[model samples]
Target chain A: MTELNELTIAEARDRLRKGDVTSVELTDACLSAIEGAGALNAFVHNTPEIAREQAAAADARIAKGDAPAMCGIPLGIKDLFCTKGVPSQAASGILEGFTPEYESTVSQKLFDAGSVMLGKLNMDEFAMGSSNETSVYGNAVNPWRRGNDETALTPGGSSGGSAAAVAADLCLAATGTDTGGSIRQPAAFTGITGIKPTYGRCSRWGIVAFASSLDQAGPMTKSVRDAAIMLEAMCGHDPKDSTSADLAVPDFEAALTGDIRGKTIGIPREYRMDGMPEEIEALWQEGIAKMRDAGAKIVDISLPHTKYALPTYYVIAPAEASSNLARYDGVRYGHRAKLEAGDGITEMYEKTRAEGFGHEVQRRVMVGTYVLSAGFYDAYYNRARKVRALIKRDFEQVFADGVDAILTPATPSAAFGLGEMKNADPVQMYLNDVFTVTVNLAGLPGISVPGGMDRQGLPLGLQLIGKPWEEGELLNCAYALEQATGFVEKPGKWW
Target chain B: MSIDTETAAKVAKLARIRVEEDALPALAQEFNTILGFIEQLNEVDVDGIEPMTSVTPMRLPRRVDEVNDGDQQAKVLSNAPDAREGFFAVPKVVE
Candidate 1:
């Protein structure tokens, strides 16, 4: 029999509903699995007590036949989401020992829908960095090793822990926040499915902000159908988030008809970067063929401004980051360094922030401040915004040409070693976000589905960028692609 | 587009992050690399393109300016590093 911990959210839900298995049994199995997988460093804080409590409640609800789809499901939450009374740091020293008094909208919704909390997972500090190396809790190692090399690889970030946990079977599914490829890139690296919905599709009231305009939360799961179902449960309007869209939630699971009979999938010509690895290119072609086999018309499209997406994203994201992070002074909440007499308020703020933030967070904050400064505002910030508009227009033009979704390689390559990128130039590290950032820049819904593996046998993913507010149709297209590819290889647990 | 140590110091101070003197050179170099990457944006002509503030084409939803709920000071102060008498306590700013 498959271990209870190995079951997908959908499978566990079915078992719990039919009384074949109880929520408590599944929760205990996951707790033991997480306990044994400490070498992965996926979970930073374990709430076995809370997990049991929720599981018992869920079993009661299941017995009463009053449970939702996510009821009795155990999940790991990316440390970015504020779970009340839980240590809700975004894996940043500044937020160390800080527990939120209220639950973030997304996590609260998950709990309200009957999901059990297994623990808080690790992530990049302040949701920065492409690799999990910047996490205050240390790196969450990828379970997928490159054929006995033993060089622990990265699971991508700032949703690194979310991806690692779900991929390692530490949790059935995990909540992840993506501000410019945090969700999709990590999901690709870890060989799980992740979706970043259209901006405002989910409320972001309590998820720690990192580039407010770009940050959107979604689910990372073992399968595409699980992603669709969790995404529907995770999305809805909230009064606390002013930007949350006032729209009705759809039955995303029902929409996954697995038929793309009359759809048109666009292949953006610009995604074929110079010197892309042959494997990634081949995997993308395979994805295109799979979609074509599913009865979808494939058309070549042009997103002319694609080359400028990274730089445009950097300027805009960091500028917004600097402003959003200004609230983290040595004030009412979070870490505050000890101060000596006559060490005035300025010193207090400077010392607290400098001591609290990691190197990358401070670097981005400085860059953001510099770009938004008076002298460079029009040249950098404003110019990036205009370029962003052009980038959005590029997508708009393609969609207007009657394309249902656009297909591209999720990442340039497969899982890389943890310290492999440490000494390289930061710009090179930022290059990992190259293919994934454009979707965030446009605020469109995007999903990364595992397409195939590389020569070394590490997983690679294909991304689907969908029309704004058309996630249901987008998920169906992804389902068709997923069925045709049938790539469901889970990482062999070496941890 | 290159950044010097002096400009790097200025930017760090402006952002309220302390950078040691020895680190300024490295910071300046990193800034140069980032600026160089961003310079690629200059090649694209964005004439007549309005800046995209958001992807959703909706007006900011406004609510009536009235107190919906409040008075839970304990919950608000639960996470504070220092709290006193239903308020957050910070160092004195003025004599």
Candidate 2:
């Protein structure tokens, strides 16, 4: 029998309605599991008290016979989303001891829907790095290990902790934000499901900003069906966030009919990188074969500007990050430098920021400052923005031509050992987002579904990119893909 | 385009982060490597293309310029590292 902590949100909901289990029992099971799993470093902040209180309230709600789908469900929130009275530092030293008086719009929605908060999960500082190593709370270790090897692999980051927790069944599911593949790449790395909905599908009101134009919040789960259920609960129109779409939240769980008979799935030729591993290639082909056998028409498509996505992203993301991060000036809130007798305001700003930020965060800030500098703005920032248009246009043209979804490999490789690439060039780490960043730039909905395992027995995933603002349709395509692949592998409990 | 140590120092100052003089060389080298990678954008022809302002084509939803809520002075200053008399305290700016 599956452990209570391991039950999917859908299962837990059904059992909850039938009175087979109370949420407090499930919460206790998860809290005990988290206590035993310290090696993963997944849950940075444990809120068992808050969780128990919320779970008890959920039980009371369900007893009244009017509970939503997410009622009684426990979840791990990424540290980026500020929870009222929780130390939401975005895993940065700059925000030490700083707690917010308000909750982020996304977290509030989940709570109002009767969900329980497990705790704040770990992440890259300011959501800047592709690996979780840059987190001030320490890196979140991937629960999945290579066959018989003892090396600790990364959970692929900035949402690394969310991926680790979901993969290890530490929580039912966790919220993740994807700005150029933080959610999808980690989901692929840890053998789970993650979807980055259309850019404005979820509100970003109180979440820490990385790149304003690209960052989006979505669900990371054990199955595509859970992603659908949780995503419906997480998204809606919020007047607090200007970018959030003022549209009706559909019953996403109802859209998963598992009948994608006549959808057109596009196979983009440009995603075939030169040095990609054969296992990833085989995984992509397997997804294509599975979708074709499910009666979906597969056609070869061209995304001509795909090769330039990463370089363009590095330019734009850092440039925006430099601007957004300017708020940490040792004033108003967060860390402040100790001042000498002769020190002035400028000196205080310099010392505080230097002491607060990690090396990767500092590097990106410098890169951003350099690109947005007067001399290079037009060459680096403006040119990249124009290329961004072309990239988005590529998706629009394809979708306009009746391509319902695009299929590709989620990551270029499986999870690497922690510190494996630390000695290598930073550009090597940036290459990991190659296949996943285009979805963000084009502002399209994308889902990473675990399809198969690598030779090392690490999990591999296939990504399905869908049209903008059509996540229900995308989840259906992903549901059909999940049914065809039937990937149900779980990570062994090493932690 | 490559960055020198002097330029790196200038950027660090501009960004309000202090990079020690000894660390400037390493910072400049990292910048050059990233900038060199980003040079791939120059190969694309964007002669008449307009830079993208927003990914979605919708007009910005403008609200009437009015204060919807405020008056929480204690809540706003609660997270400050240094606060005094309902205000954030900082280093002396003027003599």
DockQ scores of the candidates: 0.78, 0.90
Candidate 2 Cα deviation (angstroms), residue A334: 1.3
**Tens digits of lDDT, candidate 1, A93-168:** 9998899888999999999999999999999998898889998999998889898788899999889999999998
Identify the leading candidate in terms of lDDT.
2
| Per-residue alpha-carbon lDDT of candidate 1 for residues B7-80, written as tens digits (9 for 90 to 100) | 99999888887788999999999999888899998898978888887777878899999999999889888878
What is the DockQ of the complex in model 2? 0.90
Q: Local distance difference test, per candidate?
A: 0.92, 0.93
What stretches of model 2 exceed 4 Å from their correct place?
none
iRMS, model 2 (angstroms): 0.7
lDDT of 2 by residue, A185-284 (tens): 9999999999999999999999999999999999999888899999998899998888888989888889999998999999999999998888888988
